[model samples]
Target: MMRAFFNRIFGAKEPEPLPIAFGSIPGMLDEREAAARAMLKEQTRDPEQNIRNGIAQLQLIVNAIAGSEHDPEIHPKLKSIAKNTLPQYIRAMNTAMAKELPNDSEEFYPAAVECVKNCLNSIRGPGRYLQIVFPDEMKASRKGIDTIGREINAITVALGAYRKEMAALSDARSRYAAIISCSEDLAKAAEKNQRSRLRIDEMTGRLKEIGQEMAAMPSDPGMAQFTEMKSSLHQLTVQLEEKTRTYAALSMTASHVLRKAEKIATKQKHNDEIAFLKHAMALLSDHELPSCTELNTALAAACPVVERMIGADEIVLKNKEERAVFAETGRFCIDMVQICSDLHAQEDTCRIAHEALDAHPIHQKTGSLEREKVQLEAMLKKERQSQTELTEWQQKTQERIPVLRDELKNKMEGIIGRTVQYSDVFPESA
Candidate 1:
């Protein structure tokens, strides 16, 4: 009955004792909390030491905000506020450090005591008394104003320099404009001279064309009239050549003269102007006729030479025509200064006849030889056409050959396999 009663009270198998790991008892946790509280009490015991350490920590916080060093102990909630308020705190600290301690005044002693009290109060709470304890916060508040003043000063200096630079640039631009104007004037003068040169070139080309035409005509009685025409053309050519040469020379001289005048006009400095004027006077007084007058005189002198050359050319042309006419007709009817001037004149007529024959187009087919040539060309064309067809057929045959070979190889393999199987079955019978 006693055993049953014990089992009823303690449970039928006495429950296994609850397992407990070492060092997990409630007393151990209570002892740890007590130790932590004692350490905190010890740290806060000396208020003066706490103040010093707090001040040092605050200095570190200020340094971190100022970008001088980092503070690991600063709370996250306070970090942003501390960063913004640190400059003011540092300024206050600096004011306190720089304060002149009053030696003879009782009022100053109370004020100093009150200042310490304010600092202690600030440390205990939200730190609003920090501003009252230190006066340098006013200086720090004016820092941005000081920066603005410095910026304004820098902007004024920069504006003055820029204005001076603008003046210099304007002067440079004026000088550049003068240079461009001078270049444009020079270009215009060059264009004028180039036009004159082109005119001269055209006249030269016309003279050469006339000369060629004169050389190409056949000499006949009708050619005697052309001989007079040729004489006129030769005189025209000589006159043109002389005039063109004169104009070209005059143009060159004029260009030089204009350039010298331009140089004199452009020289504005005193020494440069005096030198240019002296040079101009020397050029003007140089004892030669001006280029235009010299060219005119030269052209006038060439006129008589041109006429004499034309007369000589006319006489030669007339004599050549008369000789040619006589050679062709076997009679000399026209009156000429010389009739038999050249013995080869007859050979020249024969050569001209041969050239005419070579240049003439064929009118009638010549004999059976033409028919044979036509037949031969037709036969050759047919042969070439047959060759082209044969080449195409050969290309097609070559393409088909590879496919046929592949088919033959497959048929041979099947036949060999079937024959081998039949031979295996019939070996004993054979």
Candidate 2:
């Protein structure tokens, strides 16, 4: 039961038996014939059918040695016999059977007989001595026999490749004939493209002539009239722009005076505000009731009056209205200019006072907040240090529990003299 449980946990073990190798002569011949017959069946079905029946028999003899079923130590010797030694004998046999010996080589037939005999010595079967004749051939000339076999194999390969190439050439000729049959259609398309090209050239020439005529034609009378009117409109636009600038400057000056009077009234204390308003009323009275009517009229009037008031700067040609405002009584314009200057100067003083007020509050609050932030950061650093120490202590405690459990399991196993289940000692770890 313990052995079975061990097997269940670690998986079963079994040894593999070796495969058998062929050594009996009858068994070798039987395998050779079977392989040859199988190869012949497939060769007959192939379209090219180039594998000769004689070659298939030779291939079977080669397989008897080169095949993977032999022992490793004997395999190399068997491979040399099948691939090199026997091929020489097979070539001589085939050549003699075909009766293709050279006229000058009388000893070639004797050599063929001797090579066959040597090969038969290795392959003993039912009918071997009768198939090949043992002749009185030179033992020293075996190398020449081997050379002849290699040359024969090369020639056979070349002949097969040549035949395949010939078949491919025949297929290519058929495709060429198919292409020749479509030549008339291709010629017709070429002729159509040529006609389209000629038409396009003719249209292109006509379009060039039309473009020349258009460039030569005179300008229209209506367009000339439009050019003249545009020039006159541009002059009027310049005069209107000048009048607009002059009017804007006059309005800006008047508004500046009113703005100054309003700003002077902005006092920090209630008493200061009352006192400034009283002073403004007294100044308005000093300008007198007559000057007030003129100021009010100029302020409320149209663009032309404002233009006339500004045009008085050039005294060479002034209208009666410009003279009454700028020359006879220039107080309103002078007073407006003075007030604009005073207000511009006061803006700088107000900016400085406002900056001082804004800085006071930020400086007071930031110092207090900065001190509190420093204390909190220091506290956070101390807490993180404590947390790190606690985490390391907990890890060390957890590590020892595993080692203690392992020690207990070892003691129990020694006492019982058998394997201990890990689940019996620590169910959670299991």
Predicted candidate 2: what Cα RMSD to the true structure? Answer: 36.5
- The CA lDDT of each predicted structure is 0.39, 0.40
Q: What would the TM-score be for candidate 2 when compared with the true structure? A: 0.23
lDDT tens per residue, model 2, 258-347: 333334334323354334333433333332222333443343332233334345431222344333433422464455434434443444
The reply for model 1, stretches above 4 Å from the true place, is 1-80, 83-141, 144-151, 157-161, 164-168, 171-178, 181-192, 195-199, 202-430
Per-residue accuracy of model 1 over 194-248 as CA lDDT, tens digit each: 5545654554555455455445444434556444554555565565455444434
TM-score of each model, in listed order: 0.21, 0.23
CA deviation > 4 Å runs, candidate 2:
1-55, 62-228, 251-430
* Residue 351 alpha-carbon offset, candidate 2, angstroms: 44
The best candidate in terms of TM-score: 2
